[model samples]
Target: MNKQKYWLPVLGIFVALIGCITINTPIKAADTIHENYVQKIKAKKELVMGTSPDFPPYEFVKNIHGKSTVVGLDVEVGQEIASDLGVKLVVERMDFDSLLVALETGKVDMVISGMNNTPQRAKSVSFSKNYYQSGQDLLIRQADIHRYHNYRSLSNRTIGAQTGSIQYSLVKQQAKKAKLKGMDKDNDLILALQTHKIDALAVDTATAKAFIQNTNGLIRIPSGFKTSSAGSAVAFPKGANSLVQVANQSITKIRKNDLINKVYLPKVSKYMTNHKSKKDRQKANSMWAYKDFFLAGIGYTLMISALSVCLGLLLGIFLSLMRLSKNSWAKKIAGAYIEFVRGTPLMVQLLFIYFGLGIVVNIPALLSGIIAVSLNSAAYVAEVIRSGINSINVGQKEAARSLGMSRQLTMRYVIFPQAIQNIWPALGNEFISLIKESSIVSVIGVKDLIYQSRLVQADTYRGVMPLVITMILYFIITFSLSRSMKYFERKMGHSND
Candidate 1:
């Protein structure tokens, strides 16, 4: 009886604990399942889709009635999803490698840039069901098609693929014997193949076909590597199950209705057809046809440089004063900031502002670029101004103080006037450098000269011409600025006389 009583109580306690866990498990899971992504989209009524518009048939920029617009099969799908959800579809363009970062940073609501779903990517973001399936293929010159039958024949040859793409990983793994060249843009990779820098280019079947049809002297061959049906899919932030569920429903409808093959592909074919006409090709190939692209680039470049100069100058003066202050803490803080910014690269700073600081607030790309460039310029400008201040003779400061002037007045009236004359050339050089360095803002999708040149290259399929024009335009801008600075320098010298 004693043994039964003791054992019965222990068993009862164990049973009660198990019952509690069983009862609460479903409630915990239910609490975790939230639809914040869908709720946010609904509240805003805008579904932002991020894509890299270099992949033809999937996504690319097209000159539609004099305006450059993103149009392709992927865009159609994104539109369908937006329509079904009763929201407006807004497209944001950037580099392929930047898509995920854009999505994660909430800079975009989702990404659908011909992105393939892989195990590696799944850990970072959620993916809808495969919307379209495609096979891998190699693009080779027609003259060498017989020499290369498959991936094996390309051993010891240079193969090219888009950086951070599935094709890049595919080439790296299967074509281990082949030297791999990775480029960020498809237009560049195609140029590399034409110029014989790379023997073959690994791309999706659709993309290869699009290129072959539009450009002469290129043919596609089988890649001869096994691939799964995990082809192109829409990516969402992790735990965005609501968005994923809705996207999957849209994808299923698309597949069942044969929309991709019948509707989307045919529509894309029409765009490709229009793009490849002899008259259109001739006009587009001419650099003169893209004068507007260059002009817009120049405008944005000048704007970013101008704004950064004004903001940086004011902030630089403040920081320089802080560094020269007698307060140890202020000096130390300002010194540390300058050293840290100067030590790191402008590219890193741009990304951090666009993607890192972006987590707290949704910043537009152009504004982010401006903020980053302004902040970066402030540090260099601060140092330059500090050196100018230090270079002034201590006798001047003492003389002004002895005349019953406060330190602030001494700096403003006595030291500053001389320092300005001394630092004129240096300040001018800093401004000139700012104009060129502001080009780095293009990486974040600001329509600076560099970014616009890439777009022209993509649309024209002529790489070298766009680069040549961009270089010339940059030279003209910087040279003009240099001459203007010299004019001011001379005026200052005459004033000093």
Candidate 2:
């Protein structure tokens, strides 16, 4: 009958079904299934880069138009990589030693601070293709040039190198009988030589050259000393293969397009000239010129101290209550925690939080600082509160109970207020102490007052002025807090009268 027409309609339906199947299938199945690091970066529309911007030519901060900004070859390369990925670039400045930890904790998408691919670092993070090669150089005081002019001459001399850098390893292995001291930044190493803290510093030739050229009283030991070559590369979190591939492509493109030569070199030359010139030293050396940086540091230091102390107070109250609890287990647990925290130095706690617990917890530096400092402060505060509570006369509790107050009500209404009044001075001292202790968080790159002082010291290469300014700021803050606290104590005393 209509067999041909019926078959034709069925054939048309079959073709339509096949076309729909093809359309539904992803053209790149691997990309969708893997959803690798590069895709995640694109989805976020921002590539977070971690850097320690104290290395000149590779990365360093410059005050441009009255704003501190990081600029150098590495920064320019980071821009290119972000451009290639069609995403915005966000640079996070931290201590060089902390950069790897930051990357592993997912705090940053990439690291481009002139990092060299060392075997130890390679084990944790994958690196892109090498973008620049530099040789290790020894920097000594100009007067000591004849003293440490060669590797053999450097024997038994104290040597400095940037911590977690290829130069650090180079100093350890190559220099004979030299005491190896690891600094946290290129600026630190330079400043060490300037301050006579270390006899010499091992740094990349380019960086050493920049430092020697710009600063007075430093000399570069002539070449012919055998040292391993260092190649700078972009680092990605381990297993970030897609990101590594994209980064490599960008590095290759940058090289082929001569971006480093045309753009980066010219910028480097300009930066070197401006930064190295004798006239710029006055500005670099002056504390007044760096007022904004110090102020920002002061603000951060105050904020962190205030927040940490508040959190500590809350936790301390809970801990004090736990210590006073009828439950033996609660008291024991509280006692152990207090001993463990109070027995250890705040620096150890900070390092543990940033390097050890950070692996599992994954928090920002500011949050980590708050937690570590608060936790430490809580231990002391708990003891203070416990003592204050016990110091109250037993007759007071008896009086409250005689009035038919419940145990909870007696503690809350009568005991706590008196305890606080007695401990207010101690608590005020703690608050002031925390402000100074907050400086410890700088090792983790929290950018507080002390950290800012270090940054300024690094930039200016004059240690005294920056530290003097920081000291003055600290005194002002602590003195103000102290005076205010005394005023409060007087007011409370008046009220009692």
Candidate 3:
């Protein structure tokens, strides 16, 4: 018997085993079932629907007499669907893109926002019957209103769209000649449109109509914006066959009976009338999309500030010592740390420390945020302190040394005190800024003052109220501290500005 022939059979067996293992390990994730989907909605008595509220006409929270109600078309339709199914409706409002993520993450049973049906989306989620049809329209400033002739007219022109939506994909593919800036959400692109950061924006016609209601100085260009069957539907992840069947039947029955049209659809169309009123439109514009989500934002901001300031001071002091150190290793290492923090993004550092580094160190979430903020802040503080130290002149240290004092004693006794005195005002301003920058922390899940405000927004859906409160809170916190420091820095002058 040949040994090679015997080895070939053995090699085939090994290959077969590896192939089996690869298939069994799961190349893709199975769609997540809605959390507690089968646990009986009748028993739970609450049916949760996911939506992005910022898209008006489909779904939005309007400040009606100073109260926020879920009253848009999608909201009405969701309520009707819940009623028909004999379950109470519960809406969990979130960012537009997060709605589908929530639905697939099993946080929501269904999503009925004005979601479009596409094969790509269908691969991830199942769609129910279409409720409404809309088309992509271009939003442009009054200055460029006549520039668009058709979607082709958009070719070679700069366009902006929300990052994740099918609109983004469409414009990217069809308008290859078009310069497109994809932003985080619809609101960002809308702001860019107003600011003229981008020449135009491609969005759904209904959304364009809604934007006209809220904004001035912009009109939709007529010719190139062709209508498409942008059908609105209820969607669940694929593999949710039972849920899909239930939803399609529910939507079909609701559409056929005119309940979807009569009750749900009208709730949004009326807002088109109010768009003409300057006072009402301004009030509407005042309502921010993130208003409901601003609860922890205040605390997060301040925390970032406090942590950054505090950490910056401590670490800055240590680095300053190294900057003055005689040892080459100490100076090089300190230089490296300072350069790293100063060169990179403070936001990325904040995230890395929170999500990545802290996992291994086991620090409390608050402390981790503080530490990251501090690390970044300290680099700047180090430079500030070094500048202050250098400003004191070498004469003071030489004078102290001539008085029979050591180098360490000269710095401690003669130089540092005066350096601090001169830099006090500059340091105070930096500390105040740290508090303002802390607002970024709310997204990282730290429940500070801003975080509390987000909760208020979530409940009230009143954007300005919580934001006003957060601003007032921060202003009070920072202003009081600065004023109190005047007694210490006796020569310090206050600036009204």
Candidate 4:
């Protein structure tokens, strides 16, 4: 046989064998049925609803059965929807802005936090049929009611709103001449109004009424601003038509049955008439009443900060070594990681980890917070370690090498000890900074100091006092840590002496 012909036949046979050999790897079924959000709710036996619970009568934390659980009209509405779907309801309390992200990332199936559908928000998520409609009102100090009673009078005055809220937009567009300050929580907005950081606040009529009823020295000027009527709806991820359909049906049923009037409005009225009396305000401001809430919050904040520092130190050491490596890939990878983490805002990272990464893997809020914070802290910590190592005289390393010490041993004993001593102050500062910044994790629903304080504010309907206490707690913590760092520095200096 000719050599070429024989080789061609043999090659064909090999190819045929390769085609015939089947690899029996199991690919998951498309499972479109299981993947539908409604189906997922059925399979999981619970519907996760996200809300910022600081808004009263819509969603807020209240002491329930001796435990702090989210409550209010929106929560009740969520319960109704869950019941209609024959699934349990779980409320995930987060910041107002985080609700949409949570829905987009599947952290929650729906956002029912009395959220208004605006053009900008509609681009990112779909809204259910309107469940309720609310008009905008200006909440001002009773003294300023005469001054800021009308839209024209709002000029140049600083007005407040919850960040990313419809009220914020109303203030910006309708009160365009006025300066608008957006805060993260209604409690904060109330505090700002009281502190005179803002002269007026644009809030929904119901919310404004609620605030005015409990809060002294504040009144809602009903005739001031004519903000276009806004409707509250449940938001779902884009393309979640099935979820949208069912949610809309529920909303229709709710409205058709007058549930909002019969159930929701009555609840609001109950709380509306339930404002704290003068005696209650005095008690609410008393430290003894809310000390436990603040203390628990401080404890969680400290734990998160401590763990984040330790994790950061360990990971930072590795990253520093990687960056210092002679290998090109290691240097590039470590450098890129450090820059990326340092470049992005920590809040964005926290959202990505808790909701975005959460799509692939389920992580507890506390663990997710620690991991996100540690990763962020690690980048700075690595830089600190690297700088400390570089500050050590090269001669010391060379002398250690000349004394027959291995590079690893010299780094372990002589270099690291000295670098730690040199960077002790910086490390302490990082820890202290983390203590303060840990409040950001509250957006992910971690009940840290700020979260606890917000809860106290809601419980008491007095924002300034709780915040003042929180500020003092933070000051005390940071001051004590600052002093400890100074002591450590002095001890290190004396030892060197």
- Candidate 3: 10-residue stretch with minimal lDDT: 23-32
Runs in model 3 with CA error above 4 Å? Answer: 1-36, 40-45, 84-88, 106-109, 143-145, 222-230, 271-434, 441-497
The model with the greatest TM-score is 1
Off by over 4 Å in 1: 1-32, 275-277
lDDT of 1 by residue, 27-49 (tens): 33453444776888989999999
lDDT score for residue 168 of model 4 = 80
The candidate that wins on lDDT is: 1
Error of 3 at 20 (Å): 25
- Residue 402, model 4: Cα distance from true site in angstroms: 2.0
The sequence of per-residue lDDT tens digits that candidate 2 reaches over residues 307-425 is 89989999999999999999866776687678767878998778766655554456678888998999999999999999999999999999999999999999999999889889999
**lDDT at 39 for candidate 3?**
46
Query: Number of clashing pairs, model 1?
Result: 0
Worst 10 contiguous positions by lDDT, candidate 2: 24-33
Of the two candidates 1 and 4, the one with more favorable TM-score, higher being better, is: 1
For all predicted structures, in order, the TM-scores are: 0.90, 0.87, 0.60, 0.86
Candidate 2 versus the native: TM-score?
0.87
Question: Alpha-carbon error at 238 in model 3, in Å?
Answer: 4.5
Instruction: Specify the poorest-scoring 10-residue window by lDDT in model 4.
Output: 23-32
RMSD of each: 11.8, 14.7, 11.4, 9.8
